[model samples]
Target: MVEIKEIEKSFGRLNVLKGVSVSIPSGKVVAVLGPNGSGKTTLIKCILGLVIPDSGNIIIGNDNVKNSWSYRKNIGYLPQIARFPENLTVNELFRMIQDLRKGYANIAEAERCKEELVSVFNIQSFLNKHLRSLSGGTRQKVNVILSLMFDPDLFIFDEPTVGLDPISCVRFKENILKQKEKGKTIVLTTHILSEVDEMADEIIFLLEGKIYYKGSPDELKLQQQEATLERAIARLLEKNDNKINNQLPGKNN
Candidate 1:
């Protein structure tokens, strides 16, 4: 559904994404895994057209994201931190989003989806509360509801489960599975390995702005000689460290 071709981006002298390339097929759940400063967020932003790459192309379906804004209507993005107008009540905020997306989304379906999401996340009562009055978990639930209400073709969730309670977390995962079952393409970024194991069909592991590993979770575990996804990732990092150390000057002196 999305193809990134030899993308490179740098901020001042600090390079972020260097020649990164990957294709995410439709109906697949791909997990973007990386430690801090690994360019995961930057890569996602590039795809969203929020951060322009120095040189490269991002293709969403047949449309190139360059100088485009319409394609974003088909994307449901839930950022790690969503800031809403504090004065708006939850219901009012949802209504405002619906108004903003009136032409892009089917109003009837959006309303039905919002109802279902509010129920699933159990945020019906919080709907009447102001955004500033809700707790972090409540606000997170609202964010999830808003993202899924439109049933977009592509879903980009960055640390989506953060601030969600255990029950809400499980519900969120279940909702993601339901979306996958409907043949939607999903791009997920999270530090939670167990969540990746459960929902991801493919893994894109990045290190220092490059794709260090890309494959199925089980394949990664086998290649890294580890029993769990967490351990496998650790082994992969160790290999990177070893490779870097081996290249240092005067290493054998």
Candidate 2:
């Protein structure tokens, strides 16, 4: 597990996180749903300490993030924007990241794992090619391979399936499920509603820098009188926003 309590973050005049709070249990896949400017990415950044929160706390496995920033070394993150120095062949990049990971965990066997993953993901064909020569989908595979390189305890991914082909997307989800079976916790955000319904054990709907709802997909659908998770989410947010508007200072409740 992980716990976030009333965490707030602001960038100048823009308040990205307005007292956001979420708790995720171990071995679960939690999906975050949101539209543009909804603070979903900001919340993830706060969790990773990439963006400092204005207040509140993030605790993971009994360790306070503020107290021990090193706790993050145990987590694997696949950021939305992945950048790498071009001209380096895929093999070289793998070696470099594996080397950097050694300093983080002092793992003596990381290179072995990296090679195995490269072959498993069918990335070997692209390994000798320079990064700039690969397609976007191939680059995405590389990004995912790198994030899962260490097989860290907690995996945080943003739009992980973007630019991937159908087969690759399915393979990626299968890998995530394998990680889930290993009792690893995962948090990710995606625009693909069907994938969220398929892979998520729980859902957190974020809107305007707040958690609109958090629960199982089944519970959400039945409550919202919808058969699909997508419709259910739309109903829930619409209902909540209607209530908010109804209670506005000059409006009738």
Candidate 3:
């Protein structure tokens, strides 16, 4: 459902994505994995049109996302760091978002989804509380609810389970599975290898602004000759350490 072709992005002297290409099919959960500064977030931002690529294209369904905003209506994005108005109460925030998206989203469906999420995440008790007063986990739950309530065709979650309690994490996984069953496409970025192992159908591993590996978790482990996803990823990184170091700025030839 998503296609990226020879995408490249550079910021001043720093190149973040270098001719990266991948195709994500519908109803699949794809995990984008990379170490710090590997351009995973930049790639995602490019797909969402938050960051424009210097070359190539990102297409969702048949729509090229470049210089476009309407395509975003089909995507539900949960950013790595969700920042909301501190003074707004949870209910107020929901109402405001609903207002902003009135013409785009089905009001009855959005309300039904919100009710289900509030119950599932146990957000009812804090509905009247100010966002500033909620704990990080609670705030994260709010973020999840906001992103999921629209029932968009595509879901992009960046560190979605960060700060979530154990039970909430389990619920989040269940929710993802439910979405997958409904044939929605999902793309997520997380440092938790275990979560990827448990949830991802495919993995896209990036190194220094390029795709290093793209396959299933099991395929990755087998390819790296490792028993587990964590070890496989570690081995892959270790194997490429020299290449990565040499590519760093100021490294002597």
Candidate 4:
């Protein structure tokens, strides 16, 4: 559903992505896993056009992402942090989004999923409250609802479960799987290894601004000789650290 080719991005002196290339297939859930500053967020932002790459190209379906905004109509993006007017009630916010969505995409299609998602998240009681009055988890639920309301073909969720309660987290996972069943492509970044094991069909592990590993969770675990995805990732990071440390001057090989 999406293709990234030799994508690179640098900010003045710091390079965030170095020749990153990967393909996300349709109807699958792919997780991007990495530590801080590993380029996971940068890669996702490049696809979203929030951050333009210095080189390479991103193709969604058949069209290139450069000089194009229409492809976004097919994408539902849940940012790690969603900022909005705190004075607005949740219902008002939802209405505003529904109204704004009309300009770029099918508002009817977007509305079809709104009620179901709101019910799934059980945020009916919070809708009349202002955003500033809601707890962190409640706000995150609103974020999830707004993103999925579009019923887009592609879903990009960055740190999606950050403040979600256990019930809400479970609901989110189930919803994502249902979307996958409907042939929608999902890509997400998260630090939670258990979530990756449960929801991801494949994982693309990033380290030092590049893709260190890409495959099934089980495959990665077996390759790293670890019992769980978390341990496997830890081992991979440890190895990378040792490799870098050993290359330092006067260090043992």
Candidate 5:
């Protein structure tokens, strides 16, 4: 579904992504796991064309993402932080997005999907309320609904369960699984290892703007000789840290 080849990005003195490359197959849930400053979000932005990479190719389906905007129409994106017009009511916000994407495949189907998502996320009671007045979890629910309403082919969720309540988080997982079952590609970035263990078909572990490990969760645990997904990732990071320290200037091997 997506292919990233030798992607590189920098911000003045800081190199964010260094020749990162990964291929995401269709109908799979891939978790992009990393610590802070690992360039997970940067990679996602590159794929979405929100941030252009300094070099490399991001090909979704068959088209390169550079200087392209139309590929986004087939991709549903839920940002890590959703910032909307504070004064707009939930209903109004929904209407605005529906209007903006009026060219979606089927108008009636999109509306029906929106209504279904509203009910599933249990946001009906707050539809009339302004976005600024909603709780973080509630707002996140609205964000999820808006992203899923159009039923895009690929779903990209960044920190999707951040503020969700336990039940809501469960519902969100169920919905994502349903989408996967229907053969939709999913790419998620989150710090929650347990969620990754539960939902991810493959894990792409990133560190210092590079893919440190990419495989199934079980394979990672076994490879690292760790008992749990969290421990496995921690061990990987520690090993990388030691390796880097050993290679530092004036350091003895």
Candidate 6:
């Protein structure tokens, strides 16, 4: 459902993304895993049009994201941090969203979806609370509910399970599986490998602003002669370190 080819994004003299390319198919779950400062966030932001790429093309379905806003109607995104007007109650915030999307969302449909999401994410208990009064976990739930409010063709989540408890995290994963069964494409960034193994059909391993590898969890294991995803990643990093050391002109014993 999404295609990025030779994408490059640079911040002044520092380049964050260089010649990155990946294709995510529809109705599948794709997990992107990377260490800190790996440009995973940058890549996702580029897809959302938050950070414009210096070069390369991002295509969503048949629409070129740079050239069309129409494709945006089919996307739903949940950021790691959600910012809301502090004074608004959860109900009011949800209502405000309904008002904004009235032209695009059928009133009954949107209301039904919103109610389901609020219940699914267990946000109903905090419906009367203002954004400023809610806890981090509660706020995260609200953000997730907002993403599902549209029931769009594609769902993008960045560190979506960050603040949730175990039960809540399981529920979130189940919800993702349900969405995939309905033929919705999903792209999520996560540092949790166990969760990725359970939820992802394909894994995109991004490192230092580029795609280090992309394959199924089992395939990745085979790449490193290991039977586990964690081992595979450990081996990949060690291999990269050796490669870097080999390139140095003067080396230590």
| Residue-by-residue lDDT tens digits, candidate 5, 120-150 | 8888899999999999999999999988888
- Taken over the whole model, the C-alpha lDDT of each candidate is 0.94, 0.87, 0.94, 0.92, 0.93, 0.89
In the range 1-253, model 6's lDDT, one tens digit per residue, is 8999999999998888989999999898999988988898899998988888999999998888786677777888999898999999999998998897777767679789888878787777899988999999999889888888788999999999999888788888898899999999999999888988898999998989999989988898887899878889999999999999988988755
- Looking at model 2, the pairs that clash are none
Q: List clash counts for every candidate, in order.
A: 0, 0, 0, 0, 0, 0
| TM-score for each predicted model, relative to the true structure | 0.97, 0.91, 0.93, 0.95, 0.96, 0.96
lDDT (C-alpha) at residue 199 in model 6: 84
TM-score: the better of candidates 4 and 5: 5
Q: What is the C-alpha RMSD of each candidate to the true structure, in Å?
A: 1.1, 2.2, 2.8, 1.5, 1.4, 1.4
Winner on TM-score between 2 and 6 is 6
Tens-place lDDT per residue, model 1, 1-253, is 9999999999999999999999999999999999999999999989999999999999998889999999999999988897899999999999999999999999899999999888898888888888999998898889989889999999999889999999999999999999999999999999999999999999999999999999999999998889999999998999889889989998868
lDDT of 2 by residue, 1-253 (tens): 8999999888899987899888999999999888888998888888888888889999988888875787887798988877888989998897887777676864555666677767767888888899988888889889998888787899999999998888888888999999999999999999899999888999998988889889998999999999998898788878878998988898864
lDDT of candidate 4 over 106-183, digit per residue (tens): 777666678778888998888899999998888999999988988889999999999999999999999999999998
Question: Candidate 6, which ten residues in sequence have the lowest lDDT sum?
Answer: 65-74
lDDT of 5: 0.93
Candidate 6 to native Cα RMSD, angstroms: 1.4
List candidate 3 stretches off by more than 4 Å: 242-253
Q: Model 3: per-residue lDDT, tens digit, 33-125?
A: 998999988999888999999999999987999867888888999989889999999999999999988999997899999999999999899
Q: Which ten residues in a row have the lowest lDDT in candidate 1?
A: 118-127
TM-score of 5: 0.96
Query: How does residue 210 of candidate 4 score in lDDT?
Result: 91
Name the better of 3 and 5 by lDDT.
Answer: 3
